[model samples]
Every structure is written in C-alpha cells, then in structure tokens.
Target: MKFTYKIDEKTELKMLDLQESEQLFYLTIGSKETLREWLPFIDFTQKVTDTQNFIQSTMKQYSENNGFQAGIWYEGKMAGVIGFHKIDWNNKSTSIGYWLSNDYVGLGLMTKSVKAFIDYAIKDINLNRVEIRAAIGNKKSRAIPERLGFTEEGCVREAEWLYDHYVDHVVYGMLAKDWLNKNKIKRV
Candidate 1:
C-alpha cells in the first residue's frame, strides 16, 4: 500500500519511518503529561529507541497488509500520529486510532485528516466498515467521528487501561455505503 496521503496544502499523512524517530520521540516526551491521561502506552515510550521500534513494527504491519501508522503533518510540522490499528480484510473492516499534539488541538486538522483517511479506506482500499474508539471523556477525539457522521454503536466499560486506572470507551462505526451517501467532505 502507498504510504503517503496528502490531505491538502496544509496537512498530510505519511507513514512513520525510522529516520523520524528522534523527532517523534521528542514530540511524545513533550506531550507526555497530556497524552498520558488517556493513552496507556505513553509511559513505556521513554526513549527514541522505543519510537524507532514502533516505526519498524508499523512498517512490518504495512508490508503484511495488516495495518499502517502515519505521522500527521500540519504546515510542515509533525503534529500527530494516525492510522488503522488493524485491517480485517476478510470482514472488510478496520479500526482507527489517532493522537494530536496539544498545540495542534482545535485546528480541525485531525477531523480533516480522518475524513480523508476514511474516504481512502472505503473508496480506494475497498473497506466496507471503519471503527473509532475514544475514551468517554475525550470529547475532541470523539468529535471527529461525530462530525463525519459515524454512529455511536455502544460503550465498552473500562475498555482501556490508563496509567493509573481504566476508562470507558465510546465506540463509533461507519459503513462504506453510509459514507458515500453523506455530503462530500472538503479536504483541509
């Protein structure tokens, strides 16, 4: 699968690579406190090597047609990461996950990036269903799916283990047919 996706002039999504691990590592470290509240694995990513390993693993998954992770770039800076956790080819479905730097919040960059990815998943990749799971209190994260017209399927109680506790997750789902019927989303 192709690794780069240009959402617009201001934003783009490119597959994670080992060469960028240092940058990603610093970005993660800088956002550790903010990201730790909802993301369980942040604490484990203490060094650049961890980020490099992650990029290597993601590349392996991409080669295997399992899934892929991409770095979200906004105005030439690496602002976040977004990707499918797994693509169930047999079922024609996939689950998406994303995290943006605190500085980039409220810019609608993720919403636009996700919309473009969903469109690519359904139209180009031929995936029929896409799912997004966000922690119950993460209104900003949940809003992306909502803004793009995903249905709230249900809640998974204590679905994710945060640093010190667990948090419930709200599941959102969208089908290819529904996506195609929705109003066209303009690229950001």
Candidate 2:
C-alpha cells in the first residue's frame, strides 16, 4: 500500500522508517509523562533501539498488508504518528490510533489528518467501518472522532492498560455509507 498522504500544504502523513527511529524516540521520551498517561507501550520504549525495532516491525506489517503507522508532519516537522492498527479484510473494518506532540495540540492538525485518513479508508480503500478507541477521560483524543461525526458506541471498561492502571475506552464508529452520504451533501 502507498504510505504518504498529503493532506494540505502544511500537513502530510508519511510512512515511518528505521532511519527516523531516533527522532521518534526522542519525541516519545520528551512527551513521556503526557503520553504514558494513555499509552502503555511508551513505558517499554526505553531507548532508541526499541523505537527502531518497533518501526521495523511496522514496516514488515505494511508489506504484509496487515496495517501501517505513519508519521504526521506539520510545517515540515514530525508532529505525531497516526495510522491503522490493522485492517480486517474479511470484515472490511479497521481501527485507528494516533498521538500528537504537546506543542501541536489545538492546531486542528490531528483532526484534519484523521479526516483525510478516514476519507482514504472509506472512498479509496472501500472499508465499511472505521473505529477509534480513546481512553476514558481523554477529552482531547476523544474529540477527534466526535468532531468527525462518528457515533459514540459506548465504552469498554478497563480496556486499555496505561502505565499504572487500566483505563476505560470510549468507542466511536463510522460506517462508509454514512460518511459517503455526508460528503456528498458537503460537495453539493
């Protein structure tokens, strides 16, 4: 699958690679406390090598058509990462995951990037369903799905393991038919 997505003049999503692991590692380390609150894997990435291994694994997954992770770029800098956890080819569904740098919050960059990916998933990839799961109390993360018009399907109690404890996850879902209809009206 193609890896790069140009959302606009200032925003793009590019497939992450091993060479960029150091940069990604530093970003994660810098945002350790903030990111760790919601992401459990952050605790395992102790050094650059771990980041390299993670990126390498993701690259392999991309080749196998399982899933992918892309670095979100804003104004030519790595702002965050976003992508599908996996594509359920049988069910024509997928789940999205993402995180933004502390500095990039409130810029509407993530919302736009996510919207672009959802468009690609539904229109280009022909996916029937796309889902996002945000840890409970993560208003910032939850807002992306809400702003894009996904339905709040409910929550899974203690669904995600953060650093210290489990956190409930609010599930949001959107169907391609609904997204298509919405976009058609927008284009009219």
What lDDT would each prediction earn against the true structure?
Answer: 0.90, 0.90
Instruction: Give me the overall lDDT of model 1.
Output: 0.90
Q: Which stretches of candidate 2 lie over 4 Å from their true place?
A: 185-188
**How close is every model to the real structure, measured as TM-score?**
0.95, 0.95
Off by over 4 Å in 1: 184-188
* C-alpha positional error of residue 114 in candidate 2 after TM-score superposition, expressed in Å: 0.7
Pairs in clash, predicted candidate 1: none
Q: For each of the candidates, give the backbone clash count.
A: 0, 0
> How far off is residue 74 in model 1, in Å?
1.2
Query: Compared with the true structure, what per-residue lDDT tens digits does model 1 show for residues 1-188?
Result: 45898988999999998889998999888888999888888989998999999999999999999889999999989999999999999999999999999888889889988987898888888899999999999988898999989999999999988867889999999998888878554322
